[model samples]
Target chain A: MSPKGPAPSSVVREFIKDIVVDNRFCFSFPAETSALNKSVASFGVINPVWIVKSQDNRKTIVSGFRRYNAARKAGLETIPALTFKAGREYDLFIAHVAENTAVRKLNVGEISRVIFCANEHFGHGFEKISDRLFDALGLERSRKIYDMLLAVAGYGPAAKDIVSAGMSLKAAYRLARFEPDQRETLCKWIMDNRYGTSKSSLMIDMIDDIQAVKKKSVDEIIADAEAHVSPDMEKPQRSSRLFESVATMRNPILARMRRDFQTALESLNLPPSVEVIPPNNFEGRHIEFVIRARDRSSAISSFKALSKVAEAESENTESSKLSGLFGWI
Target chain B: MSFPGFSKILIAEEAVSTPLTKKAKAAWPDIAPQIVRNLADHELQLDMEPDPVAAGKRTLALGPNRGKFIRKCPGTMGLVCCNYWVIDLVEGCPIDCSYCILQGYLTDRRIRLATNINDLVDEIDAELAGGTQPVRVGTGELSDSLILDPQLGLAETLIDIFRTRPRATLELKTKTANIDSLLNLEPADNIVIGWSVNTPAIISSDERGASNLHDRLAAARQIVKHGWKVAFHFDPLVLHDRWEEGYRRVVDDIFSVAPPEKVAWISLGAFRFHPSLKQVIRDRFPMSDILNSEFVLCPDNKMRYVKPERLKLFRTLKNAIVAKAPSTPLYLCMEGIEIWESVFGGSPRGDKNLCQVFG
Candidate 1:
């Protein structure tokens, strides 16, 4: 149904079921929908949802999917929408993207969906879409960005959630390379554990390594990690335990070093007021000694006590032999 | 040299008159050579883009060797250095191993072919003439020794030079099967051709554009058959499942084809690299699991497998090799004295004892 004039001048009331979410701009996170629902329930949708007539005469939403869903949840029978007359498919796609861009910035995944829809529905290739259409739609104009977005778009829903939850684009791309079921489990674990981006990336790498080197299935690896967490532990504790277990499995060397360092520290038997800190990641040669003294006399005593302990321990350890040979100690 | 990654050749005006540049042109006939007054002109073309890695892979620059060609290997202070010297030949590698430190170590990605081989040979000769002590030198430090051998033809020149110097031994280490240039030349007892080997699984997955383990072993056999001493480097030994069995098969494969008497020395080094190489590998080889394993930044600023893990890997491989070839001399490359004591029960006193085996 072509518009008789320009577009609808006034907002038209349409039945909630009659408007279909456009596949091109259908991407939405659960939290986004929940917030929109709360906003609609309290003050109602402040802006009109944009819609266009489809080939079968049903109204398809160009933008404002969260508004329509929230309005439905708010117990509204109809929602305000600006209906447009059917025009060129590309023009319609651009209108959808433009309206969304006008409201707020579209995320990477959302931009990917727009590209996917434009490619599928408008027959624009990635090169054409990235070069010509991206500028017009106010998206970043770069082939690399377009390629990365398209790759992320191919990830399953759970993986998409992981990206939306703050995993980096590079990490998301790596996660997309896994098997569908494995990707879902890993993404779900990341989401459930509330892993930060760096941790999430590390966890993904751990899983990938275990799968490759051990030839274990993703289910088996996840099960092994789950076994490390006790049933009595809460969600956060369980997640932290699982992460530790995975890390141990990934780098048995680091685990052993940490154990060795702990043993070495225990052997020193320093006073409670004296804290000896090992180098971070065992990177530096100098071990930091912190004295928790409130006065100068106590600090001096702590330092003297630490020096005696170190000297005595050095004589007994293999490190002391090297120190003696080099005259370092 | 035929790889599609590099499409252009930029030759320094000074290098255009060198025999090495002439050889490069002869090797790659299809690639029209572009001559510039200096490397700075070529750097101007690269300044337009931010992605040096991508640009480096696409351009091959030829220039004279302005720095010392014979230099000491950068060994860490606390580590037990083997006193290995390096003969700087090329600046980049064509074979794209996932764990290559060159990815992060090199500033740019361009394949830098030094066109001043005569100067390099002269410097090596001078070093050998001035010193009475035995020295071990290798060409695989900055780039693979034989990966570009077919195009450069520097291996024969190096082999001839080391043949006359009794105190100097030359090591040509590579992961490729490009030994056609060396096969027909006279075999020198002082020249050791080594292959960087790993399990078959790693060969297929992580080592891109490299020869498979079977072919590399076959090349080793060919080199030994031609009366040259060969070496095997299970360097960057990966800790995979059934690793004992995988390494056992590799050890068996080596002994079955070539005798241990013809072997020069076997070196073992677990996979290690600069921390930055981890992300580079993740981006370049998404399917690779090499970076997923545990690594700690050692005092030397390189990420290495923990001591226990490295010890276990070394002991296992050492046992497998000893079981097969009891007489073959074995050493650890770029490792600390503690690790040496742990594996061999004692550490080499200095470079003197270390070079005695290979020299």
Candidate 2:
């Protein structure tokens, strides 16, 4: 069967106070009104609010909560509104949700609120409500993605904004589990520095793992990172160094072994064409040496240079330093 | 038994007459068996529950095997195989270790009793009838062999089949000390009672429902005295603080009671798992620190400690085991040939007996 649209309503002017303003069904983030106050004061309620009659024939406001709230602050006596016939409260809630979903450029906070309240207002199963809202948002059907989005409706203001600005779920999952103060500090720092998703994600992952391992607070970790980074360094370089520090903090032994390997590799100072590469995390037994020679003769020359190094006294060689990598557990 | 049995028993209408069903009904008398027309429909409801794995552990279903009962073990891809065969006697184990792969693999969490053990025995009897080489068949691959043996007496039937076959060895691996029925039975060969052992910390932390280290070793000692061969599996060697001392103590305790001649084999496997199981473990065991360690994707697509750390852990434990008992045969489970060589000083193929099963 084809789906039916909401019932029709007529526009009329009603006293802002007389219209029993019950907004439990409204789909929105926690109400903040600076922007709405400025817009309503300038535009003078360009569009009418939507309302319906309650059980006892009292009019109830359905949508345009921000506009009505702003009008109250602006000291308006009567507000223009669309009055639907009685007993269409649920229908009006869904229609307003659809209109908001289709028309508004919603932030993640707004999107999450819409999804959360739509399920609540309609009393539908979370799965069904989430499916409709995810379709409205044009998101992929990932497991628990809808649930996580719904959970965002409860986050602090800064965290919601960070998610709105495009932090990946991969990063947000870690950030969600952090203590509220830690989450807010990281979110506030991300907002203040205007770190994009990739940088924000790396910050969450590295810092979370480091603090878990070192038993350090986020404040101390951040302070340590900033103090160690030179003041004159650029923001990107600072971030890079901060990440390295946390990486080292999470795996101290591996980090030290990696430094020793690099130093030993540098001491050899092989021919230009020959480059030594350590296995990822020094986990494997083999150390790869790539020869990027320009021609056959250069390749032969690079091989001869390596042979010369091998011919040197075994004590002078750095092969023993390579063994140090395996010693770390 | 240290573990609580099933909360509810689900029996297929046709399978209600099976001896295993009657045994489960008798064991948990408070939980009356509900005749189910379609077990799959009931299992799907488990997916909708908040915790399907936990729900499956509490529910027991007795039914016929929809397919053959015996199959080759699906060893990790790109890793060495032990050529182990498995019997799906029970589809799930009650000993719910936090890192058990069954949590992710068994979508239907119900402890499905393969009620048609008669058919399973007959099928195994045919498979082992003609083989000259010893075929290592085990019921513990998918489910513990003795978790229900106190009530079901399932091991005796399998022992009857394996004891008569000269070329077959049956392993009843478990984390529980439920070996009462096995002790009274006639002494038999080609039957190894294996226990999956871990340190005290791991046992208390992760393996909440299984037997403790002392109890498991005591059970092994009991079986050893009965003239039955015993095996020890230190599989999934989880890395933890002071793990070296913990594992060394376990090895010392095992040798102090279990003679090396009674040992069928000792296999060492480092903790490794599919990446997807990480979240399951985290959610089920919120306080567990296992997932906090540094892991990398190995060639088999399973997340494991980096190769160097694995080598270090294996070498440390190998030295401890050798110091206590050098003559006992040792092999690496689901590891590369290089790891086998590094841990045992040679590949599985290098030893004549190891070549039969682990080559």
The digit string of per-residue lDDT tens for model 2 on A1-329 reads: 75575565677888988977765565565465688899888777878988776667788888888888889888888899888777655556667777776776666666666666666656666666646556666555543565666666667878877776665554565676678888888788766666677877767766776666567888888787667778787877766776677667666666777887777766666788887776566544467789998899998999998887666635665655444434432
Best by DockQ: 2
lDDT of each: 0.77, 0.77
Off by over 4 Å in 2: A1-6, A10-152, A165-171, A190-203, A271-275, A293-329, B1-3, B122-131, B356-359
Clashing pairs in 1: B56-B109, B56-B110, B236-B271
Q: Is the docking of candidate 1 incorrect, acceptable, medium or high quality?
A: incorrect
Query: How would you encode candidate 2's per-residue C-alpha lDDT over B182-277 as one tens digit per residue?
Result: 899887778999999999998888986898889988888898888889989998798898999999999999998798888888889999899778
lDDT per residue for candidate 1 within A185-248, as digits (tens), equals 8788778888887888889978877776567887888888888778788888788899999878
On TM-score, the leading prediction is 2
User: lDDT tens digits, residues B128-245, model 1?
Assistant: 8766777889999888899877777788878887888878888999988888988899888778999989999988888877899999999998888888898889988987667789
DockQ (model 1, Cα): 0.17
Q: What's the TM-score of chain A alone for every prediction?
A: 0.83, 0.65
